[model samples]
Target: MSTSPVTLLTEDDSWEFLRTQSVGRLATAVGGEAEIFPVSFAAGDGVVYFRTRPGTKLVELTVNSRVAFEADEWGEDVATSVVVKGTARILETDAELAAARGTGLVSFQNDDKNVWVSITPTEVSGRRIARG
Candidate 1:
């Protein structure tokens, strides 16, 4: 069976695709190496918010704020992906944290104190592929 290749996505389509998912891969680079981690996120007011533990990964991200976040959907013969290029910043203020919490995306079911990270997208793109 032949597989279809990825397609270039438009800005509006990319944003719309992202709105359909609540989790995506967050890609970052440090020491010339790249890393991509799956993260649960919420989008609001043109910002993406997620919670992570405070540690080395967080430190590395702070030092290199530029990142790419992606979310996608797949079916038997079709797939769609959305990618967002942006800068990430730690939300330190109580107000900022509270606002994120208010989004109701964060689960209080867990005991971990959530540390919020916000990604402001500078570029967003998406693609859809189908096989007949």
Candidate 2:
């Protein structure tokens, strides 16, 4: 085993890590139960955007806006994880939809994405473990 130490990531570093990832897990609560789903996203600034078909995922967000999102990267000798606590909102306006379309956010599965959800993170934290 590699003797590595875990270190807290700086805020800037955390955001940088998030921007580098296109796939992440979005965590939401449904009927008091936490559910997580993998989503393809586009990250920039302080917001993370994902495209999803109108279904349970959209309904779940309407039921509860609070959510947690995470993405990670792993290497032979180092690993990093970033978590985001945020609120999910559906983009309703035409401008919002158009803007999202411009980002080229895609869903993992082949489905018609009628709705785009924007997660404005309230808090972001990350950690990195690297070989000492």
Candidate 3:
């Protein structure tokens, strides 16, 4: 058990936390502007997968592959957050598509989200905040 109110989680712990969650925010930059979108995601094997339509989110990610993703959960007095700084790429190969599908990622909305995006995290960090 941690004594401190704020506990830093290891990379493995962060990924494990992410695996339990299905929604996150994907942040990207395009033309010096920052864009963030709430996404339904799945995580496995050090990769985060999400489905998106051919729209702003897709275009922005293409222009800037560098991205930051965040997922969090809040309880009565404790909150846990995980941040993943990574490179985002649209899955093109059959293997990549299969892998993304293997994670069982599905769109929360009934949209034609045929495009799959995978974020390979270069750095993953998380923290737990507890109020006493």
Candidate 4:
């Protein structure tokens, strides 16, 4: 198999690509082990938001707010990956919930997603792997 050359993506390109995606992996590290959860998220206003039922993610985020989020788009000939380093927090205000109401971020599974979490990014970067 032939591998493609990797190119670093610009900040603007990265953000634009992220805005076009709705899902990403949220990586969190607790005491000793690290976990990654697939999340259905919305990209807007320099932050990403997602809904989840109360579980490990909620528990872990409560313990450590620092987290990393990644989303990627891939094709047979090219692939793009974006990494976001941010702080995760549960949305607890009426205004926050009100703003998140119509983001079109829907869950793929049949779980009760009552808790809303938002990841505000401190660093945003990306790379593209393409055949040259």
Candidate 5:
């Protein structure tokens, strides 16, 4: 009998994997209410960037800056998942806005997504497992 291989990914490895992914779930909690939203994102320089318009997700994160984000991918024989816990804030500075524009993130929604949110991860962890 053969057992599946499991591996823990390093911070750098996790960020590298995250850079290859586009869509992730953004988790936020405020006033004891937890909410999660699917967001298209870009990862670079140890941060995650996503665009959103004024709405629940934006409002929730504003109330509570602490957030959790997750992205995953699966291959024929292996699967991987990355989770990022951090603080999220809206971009305001010109330099910050310029950096975000360079990320080249594309929104899946047709609605105007003019606001950019940057997630600076305090902790990032990931794992990969092989199919048995």
Candidate 6:
């Protein structure tokens, strides 16, 4: 099946797709090489949130905030995917942390104790397999 590029998702579609999925892959550069990590996330108000432990990748995210994230689902002969390119920022404020915790979508047990990262998408696109 082939797919076509559509305009950026509407607010409703974006929120719906994001809320339906619990996990996504975050793509970033590590040591000048591409790296992708699967993570559980929550989305709302045009921002995607997730938590991660301190490490080199986290440091890289802090230093270079640009990233791409993708989530998708597939079935027999059909698939749909969404990609978001955005700027990431570590959530530091009590309000933001509280909001992140409110997502209630954490897969990891110690998510609340980990550092929360939030991505505000500059662009978002989605595609679905064309019917044959």
**Which candidate has the highest TM-score of all?**
3
In candidate 3, what are the lDDT values of residues 27-118, reduced to their tens digit?
99988999899999999899999999899999998889999999999999999999999999999999999999999776788788889999
| Of 4 and 5, the candidate ranking higher by lDDT | 5
Residue-level lDDT of model 2, residues 1-132, one tens digit each, is: 755499999889998998788899999998889999899998766788898877888889999999999999899999999999999999989987777777777567768876788999899999999866
Displacement of the residue 45 alpha carbon in candidate 5, Å: 0.7
Q: How many residue pairs in model 3 have overlapping backbones?
A: 0
**Model 2: pairs clashing at backbone N, Cα or C within 3 Å:** none
Assess every candidate by TM-score. Answer: 0.82, 0.88, 0.95, 0.90, 0.94, 0.83
Give the clashing residue pairs of candidate 3, or none: none
Task: Give residue 4's error in model 3 in angstroms.
Answer: 2.4
Give per-residue CA lDDT, model 4, range 1-132, as digits (tens).
966499888988888898889888999999978999999888877778899888899999999999999999889989999999999999999988876765777777758898989888899999999867
Segments of candidate 5 deviating more than 4 angstroms: 1-4
lDDT (Cα atoms) of all candidates against the true structure:
0.80, 0.88, 0.94, 0.88, 0.93, 0.81
Worst 10 residues of 3 by lDDT: 104-113
Clashing pairs in 4: none
Stretches of candidate 2 exceeding 4 Å from the true structure: 1-4
lDDT of 3 at 5: 93
lDDT of 2 at 14: 93
lDDT by residue (23-119, candidate 1, tens digit) is: 7889999989899887887776677788888776697787899999988889998899888899999898998888777656743245474678988
Q: Sort by TM-score, best first: what order?
A: 3, 5, 4, 2, 6, 1
lDDT of 3: 0.94
**How does residue 41 of candidate 3 score in lDDT?**
97
For every candidate, C-alpha RMSD to the true structure in Å: 3.5, 2.6, 1.8, 2.9, 1.5, 3.2
lDDT, candidate 5, 10-103, per-residue tens: 9999999999999999999998988899999999789999999998999898899999999999999999999999999999999998898898
